[model samples]
Target: MTLTQRQAAYEAEVLRRWQDQSDGAHDLGHLRRVWRNCQTIALAEGGADTEVLLAAAFFHDLVNLPKNHPERAQASRLSARAAVDWLATQGFPAEKLPAVEHAIAAHSFSAAIPPETTEARILQDADRLEALGALGIARMFYVAGAMGGALFDADDPLASHRPLDDRAFALDHIEVKLLPLVHAMQTTEGRRMAEEGADWLMSFRSRLLREIG
Candidate 1:
């Protein structure tokens, strides 16, 4: 099968599995965007196996867990295992299974597993890119709402005088996690893209603060 055909098959399977999930932030659109990000980063970085990156990107979130879930930190590891098992059934190149598994496993921020291979590093950065810029802002609020969190602390929006608490306010998430991801990007291309996205995020925060004040 062509790359496009393989991606389509992966997407169909992912959609079928995620049909019962309620997390709007991690839907099919998010998966597609991550795949696009992967391709872009891989092109710039080179030395990455497209087949490994493709499977890893599509299946990295196979075991999606809510941010507040007790097992959230283990989601990526579980996803890795699940992806490897499923890929084995699909007759994926067995030699590349370990690489795919590592990529998916290390892609999660909470997982804290350092990416060891080029494909793993690229996949990690690509997945993280989703949590920045316009899409990041949308997802931040979406998740906050689902978890019964407020938009921001109206009186102290940027957490100037108070401790940052993303669990309580969506805006705090920018400082708590999003900005740090800019520095955490594994590949040079990913870092460049993240810096730009982070700047956009800062501008949005500025506008939001101004309007609220």
Candidate 2:
């Protein structure tokens, strides 16, 4: 099969596997966005292996554990294993399998695995990029709602008094985690994009605080 045909088949299979098992924030749509981010980053950064990046993107969330799962940090490892097994059966390039596996394994923030290869770094950056900007705001609320987290703490929306607990309130996630990602992005393009997204998020917080007051 041609590369394009192979990718189409992979996309279909990925959708099938995910159809029954995905949550709002980690669904196929999220994968598509991440794939797009990878494409954009690869073009801008240069020297990234597109096949490995695309494979990693499609399979990175194969395990799809909830964010609050006790073993959340291990999800990426499990996803990597599953992707490798599936790709082996599909005749995905044997030479590139290790790169694909590494990229998937290191993509998760919770995994805390530093990406070692260009493909891995780009994949990591692409996935994290999703957790910023306008869509990031929407996704944060989607996850918070699913987890039964409140929009924010009315008494301390900025979490000045109480300990910041994203487990209970969605908005606190910005300061607790999301804002810090601005500096954590792995690629130059990703960092630039992250800065812009962080700026928007900060502006959003200002508007929200003023309205709450």
Candidate 3:
């Protein structure tokens, strides 16, 4: 998608800020992918506020907190505030600030804010889609290694016999969090992409189990 000159400038600024704050999985690449996902889903879903969606895409992770932070759910709300403040300085349209803030604020799973606008729904789905596929697997392990989480439970890789705990085991994350993303998707395109990604996740888990067994 071709961003307008102003939008491009915003993207650059967002990327620059993220360089210092975001981890590998939530970096610029992830934002770009979510932007692409928003475009695709918006086109398919229709009647979405594209401008709000795009801006929210860039601003969604602006205040990314640690995964285990006590106030992790509040990160999206803080990001919304930061984004609105920055966009005001950049001359963003006053009329659209609420929509943009809503989209950014509603995108986080931990926030538990139901998406009221179409743009917010698309942004949420796009963000959640990031947690499903091969990239999801890579990110799962990346965070695991960072947090010193075990790769899997040695005796129960699928968590069939044990309570799932993603905080302690990376592989259990798919079961605990990623799989539920499929049903949570708001757009048709988003749901399709999420399902495909979930398939890849499931296949990897199956392969791992086979290899280990």
Best by lDDT: 1
Q: Name the lDDT value of residue 143 in candidate 2.
A: 92
Summarize candidate 3's per-residue lDDT along 180-207 as a digit string, tens digits.
9999898889999999999999999999
Query: What is the lDDT, from 0 to 100, of the residue 144 in candidate 3?
Result: 90
Lowest lDDT block of 10, candidate 3: 1-10
lDDT, candidates in the order shown:
0.93, 0.88, 0.89
lDDT, candidate 2, equals: 0.88
The prediction achieving the highest TM-score against the true structure is 1
**Stretches of candidate 1 exceeding 4 Å from the true structure:** none
lDDT of 1 by residue, 1-213 (tens): 778988999998888877788878998888889999999999999999999999999999988999889999999999999989999999899999999999999998888899999999999999899999999999999999999999999888888899999999999999999999998999999999999999999999989888887
TM-scores for candidates 1 onward, in order: 0.98, 0.95, 0.95
Candidate RMSDs in order: 0.8, 1.3, 1.7
C-alpha-based local distance difference test score of model 3 = 0.89
